[model samples]
Target chain A: MKGVTVLQSGGSNQMELADLSVPESGQDDLLIKVHSAAVNRTDIMTREGKAGYAVNPILGVEVAGTVVEAAGSGSFSAGDRVMGLVNGGGYAEYAVMPANRAMKIPDSISSAEAAAIPEVFLTAYQTLFWIGKLQKQEAVLIHAGASGVGTAAIQLAKQLSDAKVIVTAGSRRKLDFCRELGADILINYKEQSFDEEVLKATDGRGTDLILDFIGADYWDKNLASIKHEGRWVLIGVLGGSELSKVNLMPIMSKYIQLTGTLLTPRSDSYKAELSKDFAEVVTPYLEQGKIRPVVDSTFPVEKVHEAHQHMEDNQNIGKIILNIASAEA
Target chain B: MKGVTVLQSGGSNQMELADLSVPESGQDDLLIKVHSAAVNRTDIMTREGKAGYAVNPILGVEVAGTVVEAAGSGSFSAGDRVMGLVNGGGYAEYAVMPANRAMKIPDSISSAEAAAIPEVFLTAYQTLFWIGKLQKQEAVLIHAGASGVGTAAIQLAKQLSDAKVIVTAGSRRKLDFCRELGADILINYKEQSFDEEVLKATDGRGTDLILDFIGADYWDKNLASIKHEGRWVLIGVLGGSELSKVNLMPIMSKYIQLTGTLLTPRSDSYKAELSKDFAEVVTPYLEQGKIRPVVDSTFPVEKVHEAHQHMEDNQNIGKIILNIASAEA
Candidate 1:
């Protein structure tokens, strides 16, 4: 099998394409001949040696392909199309995951699109509904609006609820792109502060829920930008980690809730519950033409390094994917 | 016309039951002839002037009374036996308030007991269900177990859901009292660390919800003691307010939620909603004999200064009530 491996940590100079033996699948696992995979911030972090004892300690978590071999006890037969999530080990020609984690790809959606769904869509769905409890006619603010999670969140917010979805991007081009794709209010952070803009747009009441990625630096502003009894969920902390002394007087005054979550490391049962929740909440919207994953760019599997570089630079307007070799019959 | 007034901040030395004129009721107002009142930790804080501006900025919020006057536009009328929350005027013969802040007190419950419910019960109810989203069979940890809020929370947890209730108090005697009240586990913080005891009780899973008062000092411990996806609600800062730095990584690693709430500053619509929620969810439990407010002691209205001092000395198990002059009708 051909795959990308993280040789060591440090910069974008680490990932290498190499030949490796395909491993056998367990009785409950599906051996997938991966057709495509997606690049994410986690991949960049993993490339920089941040897996932190993840079982596989490889890289990549999103994949779409045909099952070349199903462990005899599995439900899917050979040649069945599927896409699945993993803690890592998806940046390969063939990967094995628990059958339960692999879902049959819809006939209406291509494998490339299917590849994009596992990580971004699940993340957006889990954050908005499972965690933030976003509702109709309420409001939400998504930071990094051009990123995969941001784009998926906006579409999910629009499709699942009649929420007033607002987005923040670093550039007007990205802001305009998100606005056309259903964001109700778009703030270009480079031109104006998102905190000020969100306050202005929400009539100084702040948003009902906020999907935050920029951590500690935004902690104070997040407290300021959320409404009375608002929920602020941080799924990523690209900005920084430690926060300066917080008075907490604001939390009591505004009655704000601050929570942080990561979906990948959660136990299987919890993930299953969240997966069911996501399927029930998002699949119908995807099936009907109510919402769709936005594709920003694609790279051939041989050029997977370029895909990683693009995602590392955070230059995409939506999900950046890698097209692997065609599925084996 | 007479009311309690504060001469200045700092202990009961500043709290005085001085005379003042009663004001007229607005369209949404009620004028109650106070029959009894109570002291809360916040009252102690207000005595020390820590509750800087949440109250009317004129008087503190506390109440127990008869509806001497009502505007007929809100929820009550003249002559109704009432006990409700107010920001600052309950230690008086007359108190004016928005009608919705008052709840009907059943004849089965005394004025003193009724006076004790508003601040603590409401706080616990709002924090546990509305914010924490605590569910049946989920484990909950209540700090200061014999304190008014702790006692009420223990009863509410036992009555409302089958969740395992755990508590921590300053003394073994206090822990014993909470244990007899159905707390599954009790930790005497004076002798043993609560987080370790909590871990022992929960089989190393930690608490699903934690109600904390001592801030900064207990910040790290609360984060460690809470389970994955658990909620930590901070209602007070008795130990201290300033933390040198906020270790946010722990929150993300544990997927914990941090929230702060102030009951006094809530709007009429919000409080009314909360009041209605209490009436619907909690009042029935009270009526069914499943839960009841715990009144530790009472003092005559003229001895409010004494009541304040008693609370200052931490002399109550549950709530301390201030009774007005007896009437022959």
Candidate 2:
């Protein structure tokens, strides 16, 4: 099987497409023929040698594909459509996924869109609902609003929950896109101070929750922009990781909560729970057209580097996809 | 009316047993004849010229008293026993307390014990349950194990939830006292590293939640000791307010929460809700003999200076109370 792998040789790891033996299904797994895969900063950071990611060299965390074989007895079978979290093998043509992680893809949605939904939507779901405990009439501020998870958070927080969605982006173009995704307030972070804008927008009450990607620079601002007993959920640190001089007095003084999480590397049990939650609470919104995956760009699987480069440059406003199949296939 | 007042006439504040006009109660307030009072670190901080306290010349936060005059239309009568949180006036012989913050004292409890219940217990309850979201079977790490709030938290965490309780104290004696108060794990922070102790106790899974008062000193250790997706609820910052570095990477990496709070300055409406929660959930535990207030010593009301000195010297194992009357009455 032709697979996308980052060879673990020397100083820094980089990807190399090679022919490796396709993975076999575990007792409760699904052997999937990959249709599409999406890019994440986790892939980049793992490639950069920060974390000890899954030993396998494949760089993708999200995928959609056809279940060519079922591990044990389950609803999915040969030719049955599915989408879910994948191992490092997501960038490959064939990958074995935990059956519990895979949810049946709705017939109406395309494979590329389905692939984009899992990682970003699940991250947004976990941050907004599980960690933030967002309630009706509350408000949320999504930093890096143009990114996949940020865009997904905007849609989910706005459509699914009654939260007033505020988004911050580097450019007006991305701001406009986030506005289209139902952002109640948009801030061009490059031109304006997001802290002041957020405070102004909230009438100094601050948002109920903040979804942050830029870590230290935005940490205090997020704190300042949070309402009393508010939540600050961190899923990524694009700007930098060194959060020097964290003054915790503000958080305690206001009864705030600051949480950082990675949906990747979660236990299989937790992944199963997220998959079920997605199928029950989120998928209907997608199927009914109330919410949809936001795809920024698509590239053939061979151009995975370009997709990564595109996302790394901070140019993409949504999920970047790798088309595993030929254009006409 | 004779009252215990701390006067901030200049750079330094002085505690004085002075005469002041008696307070009149509103429709929803009670004229409490102060029988006992408990001093908190907040009062000490205010007396020592710390900024941001709500009221001036106020000495105490928790009060236990008889209803000498029932100006309100509530349950308390002229001779009914009660205790409640105060906005600052608990040091006086007579004070006007919000009816909601006052609760009937159990027959088994004394005025000193009742006085000790409001500030420390409520702070512990609010941080552990409401903010930290501590649940049954989880693990909690509390700093300052011998302090009033710390001992209260240990007892409550053990009694209310099935969580494993861990505490860090300055000495072996204090650590032993915390163990006596139902702490599952005790760390003498002076003898060894509390972080290492926490890791050792939890099988390296770290704690599910942390109740922290040592602000800047325990910042990184708190980050290191909490499990993934855990919460760190802050109530006070005795060590210092400003941290030299605010590294948010660990916060994001482990999904930990860092927040601090001041319970006394909270609005009346919010306090009412907290009082309701205490009445429903915590009050029953007290009556059921599962939890009790830890009182260190009681001093005469005229000895406000001595009580403040005891708290400042950090000599109390639990709460220090001011007694309005002796055994002779």
Candidate 3:
């Protein structure tokens, strides 16, 4: 089998297509014939040798493919169309996915679209509902509104909880995309003070929850944008991580609950549970076309570096895909 | 009626007993002939005119006494022994408590003991179960172990959840008191590296929950002492409020849920609900003498300034009470 491998002599964007053996399916695993894989910041981090938890030498973390071999007594069977998070090795001809974490791709969704759903949607679901506990009609402020997780969170917050979705993006195009996906308020963070805009939009009460992707740069603004007893879920630190002279007195005074999380580092059992819950609640929305995956563009497996670069440049509005195999074949 | 009032001529410990009209009970309130009032840091803040939420000029937050007038259609009746959080006039001969927030004084407890229970116990309850969401048999690290809320938390964690209670205090005597109150591990924070002791005690996984009272000073140590997915509830900022050059990456990497809260500033309805839930779960234990209030000592109402000074000097363990009227009478 051919897979994407990081070069030992490392620098930025050091990856090569190399031949490797097909992974053996474990007791509760399925061997998948990879159709398409999604590119994420985690993959970029893995390529840069920065992600400590990326134990699997392979580059990809999520895929949409066909199950070639299923585990004994597993729900999935051979030839079933599926999409789920892979332990790694997703940018290849074949990959192994845990049976419990696998979700059957709907007939209406294409392989490329299916590949985009698992990581971002599940992360958004976890942050908005599982961690943030966003209540019905509550307001949520999602930063990087056109990014994969940001886009998914905006839709999920609106669809599942009937929440008022407020989003911040750097450009008018990205903000428009977010607005099209049910965002009630859009702030071009480059031009305006997002915290002031959020306060004005919410009549000074502030949003009930904030999905913070920019950590240090937006800490004070995020704090200012959240309501009393609000929830703040930190999913990324795109701008930076270190904060200087932080006055945490506001957190106490506001009674804010702040949580930081990453989905890739979670245990297999936790992923399985999250996947199951995500599938149960969100699959119907996909099938009904009430919610859809936003695929910005797809790159052939050989152009993996470009796909990563595109994400790093913040040029994409949604998921960037690496086409591993032609589904028509 | 006589109440402790902060002097307008500003200075530390500037409080005087002054004649004041008896407060009239609201629609859902109980007018109580106060027997005892518990002294807290809030009282000291009030005396210094530092408490922004101290709407009433009187300087106390919790009281225990007999109800002299109950709401027209309330649960309590005249002559009923009650203890609860007061809006502001707790350190007075006559104070009014919200009927819904009032708890019946257990027959086994004295007025001073009952006065000690409401604020600390309720604050501990809010931090531990409400905000922290501590699970059964989980390990908890309580800072200021011999302080009012710390002692209450140690007892509650042991009695209610059968949790492994680890505590940190400044003195061996305080640690010993914590041990007597069911704390499993005690660290004299003055002489020992508390984070190292906590890690050693928990075999490096760290505690599941932390009741943090010393904020900025303990920030890093508390971060190091909590387990992945741990809950850190900030209920006080005694050490300091500003954190210099703080790194927030660990909060996300460890998936820590951090919340900050103050019981005094919470809305009336919230307090009523918290009081209701707390009384339902903890009243029986109080009645059985299984969980008793830890009142350090009582000062006559006329010596209210001394009580504030005692707390400021950190000379007392558990609660310091202001005796307003003799309970026997």
Candidate 4:
């Protein structure tokens, strides 16, 4: 099997394609013939030897594939279209996925689209509903609105909870894209003070929940934009991670619940449970086309570097997928 | 009726007793003949005109007394002993308490003891179980170990969930009191590095939940003391509120859930609900004398200023109570 490996040399790491043995599936796992895999910031971090939790030398964390060997249980069968989080061999021709974490790809969705769903959508779902506890009709401010997780959160907040979705993006194009995907209020972060815009949009009360991708840079503004007793879920720290002389009095006065999370480092059981819940609630939406994974672009497995570069350059609106099936064939 | 009033003259405020009209009970409220009232940091803040939520000129928040006039709902009769959180006017001879917030005084508990319970116990309960979601046998770190809320939390964490309660206090006396209240580990904040002590006590993983009272001074220590995915409930900022050059990466990497809350600023409905839950879960323990409010000292209503001075000097452990029955008589 062909897999992407991180090669370290001269104090820097590079991603390279290498011939590797097929990973063995555990009793409760399925050996998958990976059709597609999505590029994520974590993958970039893993490739750069920064992700401590990435034990598998193989790149990628999510994939859409066919189950070549099913688990002992009758939950799935060989040749079944599956898409879910992998234990980090997703950028390979073959990978092993836990049976419990596997989500059957809906007939209406393509493998490439399914590959985009698991990591971002589940991350968004966990951050928005599981951690944030977003209530019906509540307002949610999603930063980096056009990013994969952000886009998923916007859609999920609108679709599942009927929440008023407010978004902040760096460009007009991203903000427009967010608006088309059910963002009620859009703030061009580069051009506008988002906190002021959010305050204006919500009659000065501020949003009930915030999906903060930009951490330190937007910490104060995010604090100001959140309502009293609001929930702030920090899923990313793209802007920065260190805060200088941050006054936490406002957080106390407003009674904010701030949770910091990452999807990749979660325990296997936790992921399984989250995947199960996400599939139960969101699979119907996907099948009905009420919710869809936003695939920005696709690259062949040979062009995996370009896919990662696209994400690093922030040129993609949503997921950048790697087509692994052709390379495997 | 007589009540304590905040007299704002120049830059400072003074607490003085004055003749006032008896507070009337609403349809769902009980007019209580105040027997005792507990002094809290919020009450001190109110006296100094620092609390924005304190609308009534009178001081105090939690009280214990006989119901002079009961609510129409038949939940309590006239002459029934009750203790509860009042919106304001707790320092008055007669004060109105919403029926839902009222907790029946057990035969085993005195009015002074009951008075000590509402504010601190409820705050601890809210922070530990409600917001913190402390599970069975989980370890908890309670700062200001001999403080009212700290003592209450120590007992509740031990009694309710059998949690391993770690405490940090400034003095040996305070730490002793904490140990008596069922705290498993005691670290004298003045003598030892609390974070290092906490880490040692927990085998380097740190506590699952933290009840932080000292904010900025303990920020780094609290961050270091918390376990991965730990719940840090900030209920007070006694030390300071502003943090300088704080690294939030650890918070994200550890998946920390940080919540800032103040019971005084919460809504009437929220208080009622919290009171109801507290009464349901805790009333039996109180009745059985399994859980008790630690009352430090009681002062006559006329000596309200002295009580405030005592709290300001931090000379007392547990709760400071004001004996209002003598003045009323």
RMSD of candidates 1 onward, in order? 3.4, 2.5, 1.7, 2.2
Tell me the tens digit of each residue's lDDT in model 4 across B157-244. Answer: 9999999999999888888888888999999888899999999999999999999998899998898999999999998899888888
| The 10-residue segment with the lowest total lDDT in model 3 chain B | B6-15
Least accurate stretch of 10 residues (summed lDDT) in model 3 chain A?
A8-17
Better of 1 and 2 by DockQ: 2
Where is the poorest 10-residue window by lDDT in model 4 chain B?
B6-15
Ranking by TM-score: 3, 4, 2, 1
Instruction: Report residue B301 deviation for candidate 4 (angstroms).
Output: 2.0
Between prediction 1 and prediction 3, the one with superior TM-score is: 3
Q: lDDT per model, in order?
A: 0.80, 0.82, 0.91, 0.91
Kindly indicate the candidate among 2 and 4 with the higher lDDT: 4
- lDDT per residue (tens digit) for residues A140-215 in model 3: 9999999999989999999999999999999999998998999999999999999999999999999999999889
The better candidate by DockQ, 1 or 4, is: 4
Of the candidates shown, which would achieve the greatest TM-score relative to the real structure?
Answer: 3
Tell the DockQ for candidate 3. Answer: 0.87
Show pairs that collide, candidate 3. Answer: none
- Top of the candidates by DockQ: 3
Q: With candidate 1 superimposed using the best TM-score fit, by how many Å does residue B7's alpha carbon deviate from the native?
A: 4.5
lDDT (C-alpha) at residue B32 in model 2: 86
All models, DockQ values?
0.66, 0.71, 0.87, 0.82
